[model samples]
Target chain A: MAMSTASRVRRQLPTSPWLFAAPGLLIIGAFILYPFVSTLVNAFTDRRTLIPGRFVGLANFRELLQDDMFWVGLRNSTLYVVGVVPALVVLPLLLALLVQKNIPGITFFRSAFYTPVVASIVVVGLIWVWLLDERGLVNSLLETIGVGRVGFLSDQWLLLLSAMAVTVWKGLGYYMIIYLAALANVPRELHEAAAVDGAGAIRRFLTVTVPAVRSTMVLVGALSSVAAFKVFSEVYLMAGPSGGPAGEDTTLVMLVQRTGTGLTGRVGYASAISVVVFVVTVALMLLVLRADRRDES
Target chain B: MSVMEKVRPTASRPRTDAREPRVTDENGRRVRVGELVLRYLLLLAVLALTVGPFVWQLSTSLKGPTEDIFSSPPKFLPGDPTLHNYERVADTIPVWDYALNSLKVAAANVATNCVGSALAGYALARLRYRGRRAATLAFVLAMLVPVEGIIIAQFTTMRELGLNNTLIGVVLPGCVSALNVLLMRNAFLNLPYEIEEAAYVDGANVWQRFLRIAVPSVKGTLAVVAIFAFMGAWDDFLWPLIVLSDPSKFTLTIGLNYLHGTFANDERLVAAGTIIAVAPLIALFACLQRYFFRGVGEGAVKG
Candidate 1:
């Protein structure tokens, strides 16, 4: 009887939340938090394989400001983020709307659009290289139309565009599904009401549909921009290690990966590059968030 | 407003006619000629841009080196398509071996990540004890910390564990993915808790309650988690390249990199091997595209 009453008393107590949280906290702290801190410190040091020797302070940062390769990589990364994020946001929305209707063979259409998302970036890159080679199918098709062959994954001017193209292709399905879901969540009666108002479908889309999915567009745009910023696998794989032919396709991430983990053990310099990337990404995210909030207001 | 007022139909029928908006059909569609042409043109352009490379890959992979892919007019299709390049890429490297290695690593990673995530997710979801809010915060924060930042520390850890040159290193750091854990947590949170409590009262332990009640309820989440884990493990190049130095231990992703080293600028074999490497993913996603999207969208929403 005493034990039963004691159990009742125990039941009255609030649950301790720490028991469930500790495991996740411990692992993340070790792997993520610690490393991020170490990288910040590493930004102040010379390129050392094991440990830093002297305090370089802002020397690395100063050098980075003047580094031509750094500027090129940053410029490429920015241009890529600009070019690719728009396609990622827009193409998927278009695809999602086109196929969200209960057309015959909708599943086939969906899969055809989504299959690229599943394929490995490395494979996509390699495959595209052949396809865009001077004698590739695209050029041959163009030749059939009397357009001369142009290097798709090569040529300094087109290299990043090729990477952006593949990025948009491989990732469109993911955001398409997001769009599909948002589109589904839209109350169907809203469309009907608009139709009842004698409004055409185009007016309904602009007035009702677009605003309804504004949050999703904001989200997809932000995430896509971030992914573009870290455009590593495709850039490295499609474009050569030296950032395509003659450094035309280099991004900040590529520079960090190549210089940090390549033949040289410039972990510090690479970490510095990583630091710059982290700052830029965070800054972009903040800017987007601010603009979004402002728009919301 | 001005344009609408100008274009408002002033016919005998009232403007509020209940007639269906036939905007989609070729006849009912009143899209301006310019916009209609632009729409189809843009659609075709994106489609060509998207599918063009794959078509080229298919054609080039079949062509012989003598039939240059870089010819001025570019070969849309191989004159006499051959499996010679495929055979060459397969012969040049241990293609099957690398593929198997990729499968094994991906399998182990999927299994470990799924189990770890499910257990942790349940623990956080229904077993509210203390610090639950803090855990969620940490997970969100952890999500922002990119792979580039932690890769260095993870490398050190692998070296310390003497697993740097093994597949274990390639798979272990990713075993406890925060993203998957949070995904499962959200999924589990969406599940009704009373059923789990009923199991709890029936003398079932936490594991039994989880296995019996939670797993079946969120199998969609599990499958999606599995696909993500599998793809992440499969497509991961940098981690494997960093950890596994031996050629024999190369995963398909790393093996692709090996092609870069071996054939610096040789496009044909690399293209062939690339196609081979990613073929299964293409097939798998083709089979489960909807579920994968269900997972990705929910994954993004919760994330």
Candidate 2:
């Protein structure tokens, strides 16, 4: 078998491997790699939808320095990372511990929890939009409790907060599963040892469970922070395409989409914003990984 | 000890029947009744939070126009349940046609991802040739390139090809994702080399070995790739919104966005529209949850 296999391997056509990889290579090259290169190139050129632009050489970047909307976009996107990451990193861990057992109907509960993750962000956003509307269910419930409806969508800050909450709600199950996998690898003996040492549930969790799942927490933090920074659809759907009252809720990606499309889109400027997004995401990844390493020592 | 014995049947030593009221934790120890109740209460609360919005939407969709949906102490159940809003949504927009468009894009994405990734994965994993490392590097780099950052360039590329405002343009950029390619590669790598050696000895060509021997073994990963591709395409808003300009070619997500924008006042109509968009996906998830969980586990471990 070995001899025949060797001979057949030698006899295989050289072009066959290329043939197998061609379609994938072609599609990604044309769609992903090529576009990525062009995004970098266009960041320097004063490009638009209908016009091929000349090299502008940092003019777009210089304009980004003074753009108020760019500042708003930056502030909001950064705030999203801050507002959403810790909750995602922590809540999902608690949730994973809740359903980690082999209890009856746990599968149903797990699947149910994941329902939000399965639904499109558009649907999730719209549902929240209606739910938080002045005459919506949540407001009605609030009024019944004698608390008048507070404007969730109308207020710019509240709008950002609501979108963050929706993001966390949608993300809980996904990170829960990740934490569950991490939690399983945690040895039962450690919990037993902690119990025998008279550590209560909270003590055992803080000393035992948290440390055990710290790496997974970092992983969740990294993923969620990056995703939160790039948030567009939820804010777009909730706050409208113009991005809420005075466009205060506009995220960086929403800015990218807003500026980069249409007949008179400033592609060059949008590409510069996109470059900022890319840099920040890469920095976020490195920062998390660095934090993880620092914690190790 | 008594509690432990009650939860764990002594007769069945190894195989614990799921229906036999076994309530042991993962370590096979009895969870105290108080703790179990607390856990359950927390689970129910979360379930309400997670699944409640969807249920409320469904109820709102069923509410008749005469029923005050916004009544304080909001009605949990729709009085005189009706599907009138669903009909109204269709009249308001070409919802079914948009759904069909989404289905076409999603189906095409699934096909391209599965076939393209499998072929590329086989080459990267099994068939050794020149520039294999570079090819692998290409996919890895491609996977790292964030799609959100390149929308303008992609739109321009599509326009340069004169494919903008078309469904094909909507399907083209993400039809064969690099992430799925790497996923397939990892799956193929995990398979034992000796499984395909016998086929090689039998003079089976690479295609035959891949099709008959390799492909069958990696069906789980293929299913994962297919499901994710379908969901990604279906749930996608930004790309489809950017690529397709014609309202006639709008995917369900973009169509729903249009509906929400145009008729933000009528909550019932918007609620009904969301349900139509989400219910099929939820049903799909319900039926294939086993695969979904497994996929999540595998992805987390590998990622």
Candidate 3:
């Protein structure tokens, strides 16, 4: 039997790899690739809104250019991406180093930090709403300290800040876990060598730990940037579907969903918004990758 | 030199003994005490930041209906703790039905991901056949496009297939998570080819070799993938909200939103509903904490 098998193997019959790959590839084609192309195609054709309009060349794009809400969302999203990326990159590294040691109950701390990531956005939003309400815990605490009630989810700037805070809170542990893995891989000898050279704790961390995790820094930074662009649930659930008062906290995804599903129901226009979002995200990723390559070179 | 004391303890020993003088110098003993104090102070502050709100929610959820949730001074504990809020939530909505719907979607996702991603990942990693490079490229590109960006079109596609308003609609798009496939592919690539070769020499064909040999070798990656798929499905809201409109077909997340809408005036009931929605996920994460962290790190490092 073994000889027969060896003989058959010698012939090297061609078995189609596609047979194994077909299911996943089919799903991707049906769900992602096809939709992506359809979105691009739909951006030019007004199908769902107002008398099933025809292919209006550049009309949706033209309107998107003129729309004030689009610009508001774009500005808010840009601000969000700028504000959240640095915290995700830096704070998580600090937290990761803090818990990297095998101290007693360190695992509990890690899990505590990670619990928010597992919870639904609805839950996170609900909890924050209660905590940030005028008479809520935070405001009450501030009042006790002689400060006035701060509108975390009402005042425009505060609303944006509150949204950013939630993202940072939920994401810190996830990036920390990634950094922990990278920290584990950093050579222990480097720290020892730094110590032997009389480098202080801060200096050793600066020279040894920071440089070792640079690649992780870029990865986390880039992922966080994409997340900032794709942020919807937090804003949607927190600010209601309209994205808070006057759509102050509206994100790009929120714009897309609102346009596509609301009473107006402009599918083509929503596709345009999504295309713009996709382009912006891809551009951010490319910029990140370019910088990474430059560092490598 | 005292900083070197912070080096990871050697893995051979179970306990990292505090008395170990691995980094002790002339002034090490005195400095170590301060260092440990500062370290725990910082950890405690962070612990409070992350876990504080959840603890607050738990307290609020247990508070009686008439208890002042928004008192002048913040109340950290419930004045009169009761099961009234939970009972109220259960009375208001079909809580168990929503939980079952969420479980159904999550189970289908796990099943599809385990079978589909594993097979595709194996083929991608091990086989050198036609269109392999193209398929790999397609998967990578697919991963870059966030699902939110293409959701409208995806919804339409689901409608075209008559899957809208069904649990399958929510599960179909996520059946093959590109990250999960990449993880499994990396796992398969890390395995030695000698085993597969030996199986071939013993008359085992592709399917037999894959099922009997390759599959068993990457159980860790499979478990990680399964956990991620389950979590994604369970916590999903937007897709199910868009797909299923019927209250009977609503998942836990949608149900929670509906509960919030109905009980808008009652903060305690809303708090109770949020806890019910969040508890299972926290429990799952607690049980699978090892895999959850490992999976995040694995995806990050490899990608």
Best by lDDT: 2
1 versus 2: better TM-score goes to: 2
Worst lDDT run of 10 residues, candidate 1 chain A, spans A12-21
DockQ order, best first, reads: 2, 3, 1
RMSD of 1: 5.6
Query: Per-model i-RMS in Å?
Result: 4.0, 1.7, 3.0
Over 4 Å off in model 3, which ranges? A1-16, A49-53, A196-198, A262-264, A293-297, B1-31
> Judged by DockQ relative to the true structure, which candidate is superior, 1 or 2?
2
The list of candidate 1 runs beyond 4 A from truth reads A1-27, A52-54, A152-154, A196-201, B1-52, B63-82, B264-268
What is candidate 2's local distance difference test score? 0.91
Complex DockQ per candidate: 0.33, 0.76, 0.58
- Candidate 1, residues A68-185, lDDT tens digits: the string is 8889889988998899887877778877777665433456666666667777777777776656666555677787788766777768768788888878878887898889889888
Classify candidate 2 by CAPRI docking class: medium
Tens digit of lDDT per residue, candidate 2, span B92-177? 99999999999999999999999999999999998888899999999999988889999889999999999999999999999888
Enumerate residue pairs that collide in model 1: A15-B129, A16-B129, A16-B130, A17-B129, A17-B130, A17-B131, A18-B130, A18-B131, A135-B69, A135-B70
Candidate 2 per-residue C-alpha lDDT over A93-197 given as tens digits, one digit per residue, 9 for 90 to 100 = 999888889888898998899999899999999999999998998999999999999999999999999999999999999999889889999987688778878
Error of 1 at B138 (Å): 2.6
Which docking category, incorrect, acceptable, medium or high, applies to candidate 1?
Answer: acceptable
- Give the winner by lDDT: 2 or 3: 2
lDDT of 3 by residue, B27-117 (tens): 2222356776787799899999999999999999999978888887888999888989898887889888888999999999999999999
